[model samples]
Target: MRNPISGAISTLAARPLVRSALTVVTALSAVLFADALLSAPPAAAQQGFGNFFSYQAPKPRRTAKKKRQVDPAATQRAEPGKAGEAKKAEKSGPTQPVSIIVSLGDQHASIYDANGFVTRTRVSSGQAGHRTPSGVFSIIGKSRWHRSNIYSGAPMPYMQRITWSGVALHAGVVPGYPASHGCIRLPAGFAPQLFGMTRMGARVVVSPSDVQPVEFSHPLLPTPKMQEVQVPQETATQTAQQASVELASADVSPDKTAATETKLLNPIAFASVLKKRAVAEKAAASAAEKAALQAAQTAGAEARQATTDLDKAEANLKAAEAKAADPAPVPSAKVQPASQAPTDTGATPSPEEVAAQAEVAQAKAALEQARATKAEKSAAAFAAVEAYKLAAARAEEAGNLIDEAERRSEQVSVLISRKEGRIFIRQAWKPVWEAPITIRDPERPIGTHIYSAVEPSADGSKMRWTAITMPAAKASTSSSRDRKKSKTAEASQAAVAPPETASGALDRIELPDDARQRISELLWTGGSLIVTDEPRSPEMSENATDFIVLTR
Candidate 1:
């Protein structure tokens, strides 16, 4: 008979409860391991895990095999119209990135989606006095029923503002030539359609010169430090239903119905707290720069005055030395104090000689003091200059940041915090929503990652972005050959890797059911997702831009 004790042990080990417990423990370990991302080094962007990423490598195209040369007529007869039908059925990417270009010379505008060209149309530009400025710009504002305050309350239907000074693209009369007040006038129905499709923060390149984006590799793109600043959010005034109704019955003529409700969002609320903070930071930076410059000027003046004092002291010292060097009057030197007693043989010095000696000592002291003062002044001036430079640099950086923020004010962004182990969704500096997230492992090596949306599906339902994964704060690097070997090894190893381990891509993150539902609804182009090991700073209260602290 079999041993009953051994049979009991085997039965217990095979129990479903025991296996389920083991699975749970394994999952817990994975979460701990993922947390180590911040403490580990990352690989490069191209092969394995990298701090930066780019568009996914395109699928390799299949090459048609060659056959023996045959008569053209024979080939045509064999295939008939079959080849042309096959070509018609070919399809490509589900969606592509959206970019726009406007050319003044050609009086034309073109839009490009990810795969290739999309739309091209003629446009009317600015007139003589109100010439449209040509430069690269981003669409910062859009309105269905907008009226210009600069002009005599002229109605601008389907207006899209590109500049702060009221330059826009709108539906107006395109007289086949330049004839607008610094605006690009589009065709009637096309404007509303484009408006519906276009998202906030879309690039609008207006160029006097002929230019197009081309693919070129360079070291300058992004590696050691790379990031794109985004714009803050804006609030809408009208309810969704109201907007839908107004847009349906659109009119831009002066005689249009005044009863038509036009939307005007409150800028303060519409603009995200992040944008406000960015503006405040930029202003503070400017003030700091000004103060530093003033300080530097004052110190410089003090330094110059010290040098002048030094010169005077040196002159006085030189005069004293000359008088001391000269042979003293023989008679004066021989003279003795008249009060001296005849019995006293020792001679006393005259008052004139004593005064001269004292004078020399005084001059020497003055010279030393002046030298010391000059050194101090010089040091102060140098320090002031350095301080000014640092302040100015900070101010300039802040200014640049604000400009970026304003330009990107309508874009979407995602924030991931290792400290909270949660993810946040933002648009134009406004918080859309937030969700609790978990990493694969909390104890293993993990690093900060960023993913940016560069392409969108044709229906704008799905988004595809590039990833950037940086090593932890303190991570080591291996040899080039070792890194290459690691990449190859990683590919094979990744097949067996746990799902918790991230690739720094959009899919790397796990969202709760609620968050997932939101993503499906609000997906758009050119969005950014940032993952950091840092916590949300305590100082980031109302009117504070979160980007500032993240960059810091």
Candidate 2:
């Protein structure tokens, strides 16, 4: 029913080429119309559709270049947190003995001197599996710009080793938590400062919680054996005046001399000197001891030889006496020589008898000579033996002196092991002595404790002690409420409570008289005594380290 014209349009639209031609012709006509308007005057374009259809291409961007410059000051300075570049040994630091306490609970470390607290800084301890052990340890070794032996040569600048089994304080990334491989990580700025302040054998107490050193005293604690100082003919004031005069003559300030004396009195400085002296004295004593022993052996051999000579002389004398007593019946007259005639009087002796008598006399003289020779040899041997004994005694005295020097030079370490039911003492990393000790109530746990002889009293008769008790490991069963309650109770407790607890431990312990005496004689400032429920740490090998007590 479509109209013929309409039919023709529909038929053309159905063909794709005819429809596309029509669309292009219509678009071209519209573009020509728009271009004509845009090219017209602005008033004409505004009146047309060109205003609504305006378009413009975007302009390209321009960038300015900068020239590079080098800064001399920046190049000379150490980069921030660069530990390797900061490796330096400070020439001056704390003069007295220093102690360090690391608290795993708060993740902080504090340094102390003979006087009191010095400083504290944040630290990063070990993570979950590789936990930093809680214990009383000492700085056994140190190195600058060290690398881990277990790990793949990871840098550990300003390393201060506490345990031989790889526990130490070193500079590394501290993420404010337990994140290290059983080592204590310190900040770059603090590590070098601490390293310079501390020395080998410095007591380092690593505990589960924060603890501080306090003035502690107990009757059972060993007191120093004070020796009387023998003054010279001149008084101390006179000696000082003389020294001042000498210094003045040398054009030196009195303060300079005083400073030199102070340096000499510094514990670390004098201790090192004493240690070297002790070693030399020990060597000399050993040589003297060996020589004296050899001399004794030689003297003993000579004594035996003299005895043998005496015996030989006695035998020879007896044989001669017997021959002389039974003078072979004067050989019958027929056997006698013609010149040898028997006298009628018994008083007159035969030539043969006279010859026998002369032979006996000669034997007597020879025996007497041998006796005198043996007497001289025996006296010489006795004298030599006495001389050896004197030498040996001198060597022993020298050894005792060396021991005294060593005790003064190095800190003494005492370990009271509840598991072993004994106490062990070490000096200069050597086993000085060990003895059985009785601990009351062995069944119940007494906990781990560290007591340090921080410094001597003004009178030098007693030492100021600081006690730190290790906290129990974090238990899954323990709740925050209980922890808080416990902490509150501890804080509220009387200050005397700490010293009582430490002294009470000493009361529970009973030492042999000799052990007590020896310990007293050796006790000095910077020494430490550790009481632990656990046995000796595996990190402690024979003659390799001080007493290592692992609380965990």
Candidate 3:
């Protein structure tokens, strides 16, 4: 209040100091607020600032304390009660070669043999980001007491590999959920059982949800080339045994022996020779049978004619003898026939008596000739019948040989890839042939489909086929839990692409003439054909397997 200029300067300086103090206080309050927010529960923080400042930590519930007391290891392994069930599963093993179907939704695997269902068991598949793929696969490799190559030597006992890319079914702790890193985990006891039941090349189908194999029928399904003649089951069995013995005795490298055998006993060449021989033998049998029948009929007729002639000749001879012995009672005793009667009684001087004697001799000779002719004809007929039977037997034997040759040849698998524009053939997991194919529309997806030749058709004119259509790419989100998953899962479900139906898939492919012919010639019961828009999978390694489809 003393000087006006000095007071104004002091006021400006005081204002700056006040502003600095206010800024420091505001920064301190902000730091305290951030600390409170960081300390609050995540749920409370998400609720908003209204609760953020006032949030209070609640006391733990009794149930929470109880849960903590439980053994943590229990959640990391299979249920203790399941050990007995696993043992039971191991005892009732499959009788035939088995196929496996794994359902991601249920986390269970169902096994089947050729006849039908075998057994089912719990499994643990891949978790979250490392989701296991879904598609038709095959057990390409197996190992007991195996160790993971990618996971720092983690124990993977009784591992059966489906893909060379780290995917397999192995023994591990099954915690009733998807806890694995890509491989399917089985109960400790069940794993060895499955390993014992399975073989390399066994079919394995993994899907989003549980899907059953239905009795599917279609006309477009490829049929096996029917043999004109069917060989008996007995003959086929005998042939198989003989072949097994021969193969077992051979002491040579399998690869070299197979090649040599193929050349020496070429199925095609062997079949050709057998077929020709069968046809010729059948024709010869038919001719012989017909000739034998005709000969028998002619001989029978000749024998009857000869018998009749012999009887007639004997009757004539008897009549002639009677006439020669007692010439006609010549005129009877009353009419001057005394001279004629006396002359013919002792001497054969009368012309009528001499003629009757010559007639008797001729009749006897004709009867003897007829009897000899009948005997000769009967013997000829018997010989002809025996000859016909032998010829028929020869024909049947030729047909059996053809059937045996065919049975010895393994059933072949066929794959038609629209993307590759080619058809591939494999037998015993080895490539046999390949040829170009044509798709109706190269841009359109044909979808993956597996067609199996189940058995022969009713009339036996062709093979009966059953098909299995693989799930679409987005099918992995099929489970209810997966449906309610994060936005990524929902997007995947929303982008579900429709897969082609089994019949429709077959209709799109246009096989070349040679391919069709080859398929017909090689196809057999249990043989499979795969048609898809994708090219051959990398998993179908060189001379290692049939087609391997992956639908992720």
Highest-TM-score candidate = 2
User: What is the TM-score (0 to 1) of candidate 3?
Assistant: 0.49
Ranking by lDDT: 2, 3, 1
Per-residue lDDT over 1-552 for candidate 1, one digit per residue giving the tens place of the 0 to 100 score: 554445545665666674677775665554434433323344222333322223334355699988964332221111244443322222231143455667665577766544434555567788656766654445667899999979988888999887656788998887666789889888774576456656555656665433344322222111111111122111122233343211111122112333333332221122333355666777888898899999999999999999999999999988887777663764534655778726657777666677777888999999999999999999999999999999899888877666654534345556677667887876554566887887555454344444445654332333445543332221225555664554221111111222222343233445566765544333344555556565654433332232312211
C-alpha lDDT (0 to 100) for residue 422 of candidate 3: 88
Model 3: per-residue Cα lDDT over 290-345, one tens digit each? 77667767766776777777778778888878888887544544665666754555
For every model shown, the clashing-pair count is: 35, 0, 0
The residue-by-residue lDDT of candidate 2 on 334-451, one tens digit each, is: 6666679665655766676687788778777877877787787778777777777777777677667666565555677888888999989888777889988998887766767778
Which window of ten consecutive residues has the lowest lDDT sum in model 1? 220-229
Q: Against the unseen true structure, what C-alpha lDDT does each candidate score?
A: 0.55, 0.69, 0.66
- Provide C-alpha RMSD values for all models, in order: 33.8, 14.2, 24.5
341: Cα error in model 3, Å: 99
Best by lDDT: 2
Listed in order, each prediction's TM-score against the native is: 0.32, 0.55, 0.49
Error of 1 at 40 (Å): 99
TM-score head-to-head 1 vs 2, winner: 2
